[model samples]
Target: MSVTAVNDVNFATQIRKEGATLVEFGASWCPPCKVLLPILDELSEQHGEKLRILKVDCDESPATASQFGVMSMPTVIVFHNGEPVEKLIGLRPKSVYENVLAKYS
Candidate 1:
């Protein structure tokens, strides 16, 4: 299960119609964002049917970034039923992500 790339085009539908949506706001040039990418991929694979990970390229979609109020790189926002429920900024351990998500899952 690979992380899906979200944009202004599909952001609304994807977040609104999902079981659980984890949106990663990142840029390809950011180092920390790069590090978080694999972790997200692994999580996506592990939680295949239960979770949906969406990657948003901040540089490519400034509107979505601004709408989400993502001022920094590697910002991760988890949504349930079209509303944001959790937000994490910067890099974090895989366990931390897993633990937090376990509550929602």
Candidate 2:
């Protein structure tokens, strides 16, 4: 599955979709967010429909960021059954991501 961009309006919808959803709350200019893009892409391909990856731009959707209490860029939240199950902050290795999400997928 390809990564999909979400905004304040659609953030809830994306997170509540069937199965597990990984939402990255970030800004376009955030360095860590940029570094994570390729890793997420690779994982998306590997997981296919087992996982749904979504991105929310903090700059474009401040309310959504605030709702999630994102104090920093590149905050990744994993959601299942319409609720958050895991969260990661700042820069993280690809293995770390896989470890956090593998069970859910």
Candidate 3:
């Protein structure tokens, strides 16, 4: 599976779906955010059955980003049952994300 891109319009609906959702708030101009894209794609494919990975461009979807209190370029929020359970800032190793997903999955 591939990471789905969400904007303010569909952000709520997508994250509120019936499973664990990992939403990454980022912008195209950020270097770290660019780096994390492939990582997120890999994660989506690896854990597709148990996890739903989504991306929101902070530059384009300011409403969703502000609502989540995302201050950094790459803020990763793990949502379970429509509520945020964990948040990670900046660039992190793949294993770190895997560990976080372990709790929800």
Top model number, lDDT: 3
TM-score of each: 0.93, 0.94, 0.96
The list of candidate 3 runs beyond 4 A from truth reads none
lDDT of 2 by residue, 1-105 (tens): 788999999888777556788899999989889999999999899888788899999999999999889999899999987788898999798998898887777
Give the CA lDDT, 0 to 100, for residue 40 in model 3.
94
lDDT of 3 by residue, 47-100 (tens): 877888899999999999999999997999999888999999999999999999
> Would you list the C-alpha lDDT of every candidate in the order shown?
0.88, 0.88, 0.91
Model 2 residue 28 CA deviation in Å: 0.8
RMSD of each: 1.1, 1.0, 0.9
lDDT of 1 by residue, 44-104 (tens): 9999888989999998989999998999989999887667889998989999889878878
Query: Could you give me the TM-score of model 3 versus the true structure?
Result: 0.96
What lDDT does model 3 reach?
0.91
The alpha-carbon lDDT assigned to residue 83 of candidate 1 equals 79
